[model samples]
Target: MSAAFFSATYGEARQRFLEAATRAGAAVGHHVHPLTGAAGEEIGTDTALLGPADAGKLFIVSSGTHGPEGFSGSACQLALLNDELARRAADRGIALLLIHAVNPFGFSHLKRTNEDNIDLNRNFNDFATPYPDNPVYEQIHDLLVPAAWPPSADNEERLNAAMARLAGQRNPGVSSGQDKHPDGLFYCGTAPAWSNRTIRSILRAHGTTRRHIAWIDVHTGLGPYGHGEKIFGRHSEETTRRAKAWWGSDLIVSTATESVSPRTVGHITGCAPEECPDAAITPTTLEYGTVPNPVVRRALRGEAWLAGHPDAPATLVREIRQAVRDAFYVDADDWKGMILGQFRSQALQTINGLAAEE
Candidate 1:
């Protein structure tokens, strides 16, 4: 019954999410993005609120900030929505909020970035203050985003070697966030993005005066196959200590820790806690691994290259798009089942933890 909830396209996923939310007796709202879908349909991020309107404890799950990665996130969201997950949360006196397709434009366009070609995860920064300067990303920017798709053997080796250097002993500097290079991977925007504004708005409304809040931003790529890494971040030591207590010792600290992925600059989940002053917030990312770093880098580059050449041959476009999708989302049933299982466990854990706090 749950497996059928996974959809092949953004349109299908959105429809399933809406239907499941409706069935779960949730009030849903759409923040329309200023972009059109592939088939001329409207593009927007949808939010579903299930449970008491003014519930002090809230559990939020957001998907698709990276676009294609939304597939896994959306599926897990549907599975929970169609099942008894929300009811259980409500029983615990918690409101379950599901924000679907934060970057609807990217989800529809087959690009990881939004319509402005900005990475939503990396776009969370103070405009008054300067964006983080990633010297490493700048040094290898051209190599990452080439004019040609599937660079020649010589170019591929060079780019790989440069990337290898970035993946140092600690694997620290290999991030996609860079503000200077807009056309490159991990491009942080100069201004707040539509998704950023919309998400912040939701957080401000739903997060205010909440006694406890647990947020899970779903993602894929990085770590062992089919494993969900509970990567967390916080503003201070007290918050960090409380979060560790809430999420348990197994959770990975996104910063000041060793991990397969690089430390992000402006993660959206990390910023949510700041919006909720009185709430004891625990924010983390459910990052499921799909493939190795090399494979993932190749797919990201291919997608970026494909974006650069919209006038390219049909066959080439088709090839890159499929590669990018497979890199982010595994089509196998066993893989998706693993995701759903973890999602269920985590959702339950969140409810238990929040309920205890209350």
Candidate 2:
């Protein structure tokens, strides 16, 4: 059962992913990160390639773009590695590429972003041009990440007020990439981070080889419990419509225009087309919701605040990290079962869609 696949920590999850991929006969490879994990253990992005190496259509399934959320993604990827998935994908002449732990540092440290304190999803923009700016994030930046571990009453009030104001304007969270604030909650890095570079390299290598590509990046911390939300941003409506055709009509598609998730700049899915221009790419995120928005935001703020305050108490640090991790992942058998079932259904749909293209 998938209950056995859910891991308590990053190291265990990575180990299990590798073992399952290898046992299932995937061609395993890895890109080692330069930095070490919190436990002084090494971390890296692992890739498991199934089906023909030179297949014209490739379906890339990724996990851990948000670090702590990788646990569920990793589990799904592992669960999806049985002989049946491999055979079905092969029958469609589709190659399945499982990229596990793209943000290993965050996954290992139980944080949302990478070691650079940059959101991996937001760090994928073109550096040659001017990065996107959000004045709203700047105005409420300080209030978002408080000076203390457990924010003071006044700090809470100010933040709550700002959130309400932002909400009244139809949005509040400042997730659009901000290069000015390095220590902020949703700090988009000033330059390409390691994970950004690594993913691009992957797309160029594998994506360029394929005539058509379908990518599903696993995520959590939004939507109903165990439900997988299909999220898209920074793309045209044509792309969204085509994605619906490829994935399914029932898929919940949310763009920056009307998403509960803030409108953002650089996103990982953009890599397939940008890096491999000749390939027709279909990409979207599988975001599984855990807790409600307020609870998740509080957990994120707590972790973001703790990032600035290293002197915070040990107990508080543990609690905050755990809370944020929990926000993205629900460590229960039923939740795991729900995720695995949906992943399998979506993956089969992608394979069938690719076969139609063939």
Candidate 3:
């Protein structure tokens, strides 16, 4: 199917995906919560699950955990159900679970963070584990968030200096400028935000008692545009080997390696393995690249400016919204094709891996 045919707004995509799953004879479950955004938009996080309620092995494909990033993930999910691949998986006795719009407020507003401006991915630390503090983020936080809109050239220079010093062609697993500007980009959040809480609730609600669990949390930004990097959820050699064997060694990218991928910090995977301890949780992220990271960072900066400057001109807001969308979605047939094709292939690999294990 064409990507254009699958394109949908967050709510529309969720509705269509659920409908397709139901029509395919898959059981559905929903968790809804109300959220009032900074723009006064009443958005709700609606999570839907497909497949058997108590299946031994569950293959989870989740989208919109980062809001706007849902465009690709949602399309991939819808395409899987609408395509013949879903039937094949079902016939093999594999349960497919689609978690749509994990962060609805972010998806609705085209912002990366939830209504509370919290990066849900970074909000998943075990409460008992001390929240890792990024002291470097404190030093340059003010530079990232200027008092004026459209930061001055000097501000950009300062940001470049900070990036050069800390990130230096590599994300050091700690963001610079977090302590001073908690509201700025890469802000992990003061604590577990609503989106994080909601996802945890979903995991507890649907993830218990499963024998094997495979998760593909879709994301965009950070790597070569249009390619999906399969990042491992755990560092164990056994899990890494399993991921490579299942997804093809060439397709899997390890954060431990300096290859084309960058290191991640405070990721959601930390919780998945523990969430279903009884299950051999083989969690990995299928991160489809959008624009360059620097460009993405700049777009995020624009979003932050818009969120703060609510009175900004309508034209500027629209431009920023488009930029945000282009940064992730890349409205092109080839890009969407690559995303969907890889998504289906990986989903099948996961299902087959579980069935083989059985």
Over the stretch 1-358, how does candidate 3's per-residue lDDT look in tens digits? 5575455566677667778777877666665557654356545555445555667877788888888998888888778778776666666666777787788888877888777667777777655555556666666667866777678999999889887877643344334214235568776666777767767777777777788778889888757878888776436787777777788875555445544545545677667766677877788888888888878877887887777788999898888877787787788888888888888788878878877866
Candidates in order have lDDT scores of 0.82, 0.83, 0.72
Q: By summed lDDT, which 10 consecutive residues of candidate 2 come out lowest?
A: 168-177
Candidate 1 lDDT over 88-127, as tens digits, reads: 8888789999999989987877777788778888888877
**By lDDT: ranked, best first:** 2, 1, 3
| Candidate 3, superposed: residue stretches over 4 Å from native | 36-42, 47-50, 169-171, 174-180, 251-254, 257-261
> How close is every model to the real structure, measured as TM-score?
0.95, 0.94, 0.89
Clashing pairs in 2: 222-289
On lDDT, the stronger of 1 and 3 is 1
Instruction: Name the 10 consecutive residues with the lowest summed lDDT in model 3.
Output: 171-180
Question: Superposing all C-alpha atoms, what RMSD in Å does each candidate have to the true structure?
Answer: 1.7, 1.9, 2.6
